[model samples]
Target: MLLRLPTSVSEARECLAEGAVPIGGATLLWAEWQRDGFPALAMSLRGVPEAGVLGRDALGAAVVLHRIDDRVPDVLRLAAASVGTGAVRRTATVGGNLVGSTLRCLLPAALVLEARASVLGPDGVRETDLSEVTAKRPLLLGLRWREPVASAYRKLSAAPGGRPPLTVSVALHADTAGPRRLRVAVRDGYEVIDGGAPHDGDPDTALHTLRQTALRDLPEAAWDAVAAQVAVVLRAADDV
Candidate 1:
């Protein structure tokens, strides 16, 4: 297999234009390698300095999951920590988590965070909403977001430490002169609730909103559970 270690976005773009498959941590490639052998050419994003950046409001695409739990918001940190085993977490990249189906524990958090992707393609780097970028395997430079006032995450699995079927991320952003804005994102099919925080007395309204917006095979019980979790997060944010 041919390997390309690009130290800059320009070089990464050139590699991509030449059909080199992007590799960050390469956790997703292992299975493909086992099934179909290695690709002819691969570009490692790890060597790119910009892709390795982490800050209060941004994380580079190649940022490793293991190191982010302490540095990120609670919702993103929890999602990152729950992704895989310690070894996997240490190797997995934020960009990889965004694109790989098997490693999408961070997707819901991305939605709630209102993260924007800095995509590097043949046309050069451009910013796009993390949830709206539809092109397959677009090269990611980094992700940026506005830090919310408070955030919470909950994952429900069939067994302890097992893969969770459902993950919920909720964030509360305080409006300068109005009510706090609430964002709820479910891992299932990008279900989201983006609006004013539900009133304390009207819990059922939130449930109805989730039901109206959720566009997947989400069970009734699952909606109830998600609504309850969102309510919990809102209440906690209120206290803070």
Candidate 2:
């Protein structure tokens, strides 16, 4: 397999233009490579400083999960901390979590935050909504968003730690002249974005919707536990 290490955003874009698949952390990508073999061309973003920044309201694609702390938004920090073991977290990247198929670790928070992605694609670089990245699966450079008034994250899993079967996240955006906007997202497989809150913004109804949708495949008993977690997180977020 041919590998290209790009030291800058522009260089990384050039690699993409040449059909190199972007890689970071390689925590998930390595697994895919082991099973399916390497891509013809691959670009590692680790050397690119532009892809590794963690700012007040923005996060570079290559920022490692372990680097996310109290400095970032609460919801994002919580999700990042929940991703994997200490070792795995140290190796996983924000971009990898955003683009990965098996475990979209940071997706719930990103969606609820209404984060915009800086993508470099065929049409050249552009900033677009996070939802668009979900649909188009573009090469992400980083993410940016307006700070929300409050945010929360919750998840239920059989294991005490590591990956979870389902996760729910909500972010409250306050408006001075209007009612506060609530963005809720549930992630299991394909995420369900309930742009508005559930039952005119009831957290319980949101969990019910989660039960009916994302958690439907799990055993019936598991629903109650998941609901409890969602409730706790929602209430905590409300207090924020």
Q: Best candidate per TM-score, number?
A: 1
Candidate 1: 10-residue stretch with minimal lDDT:
192-201
lDDT for each residue of candidate 1 in 1-240, tens digit (9 for 90 to 100):
899999888899899988998888888878989899988998888888888878767888889899895567788988888887999999988888887654378878877887888888888889988655534657888888988877888877666655456777887676567555567777653343333344334557655654555433476666676677677776776687
Per-residue lDDT value at 237 in model 1 = 68
Compared with the true structure, model 2 gives a TM-score of: 0.78
* Clash pairs, model 2 backbone: none
Judged by lDDT, which candidate is best?
Answer: 1
Model 1: what TM-score?
Answer: 0.84
TM-score of each predicted structure versus truth: 0.84, 0.78
* lDDT for each residue of candidate 2 in 51-104, tens digit (9 for 90 to 100): 777876889898999999877788899999998799999988898888765567
Against the hidden true structure, what lDDT does model 1 obtain? 0.76
User: Which runs in model 1 stand beyond 4 Å of their true positions?
Assistant: 132-135, 159-164, 189-208, 215-217
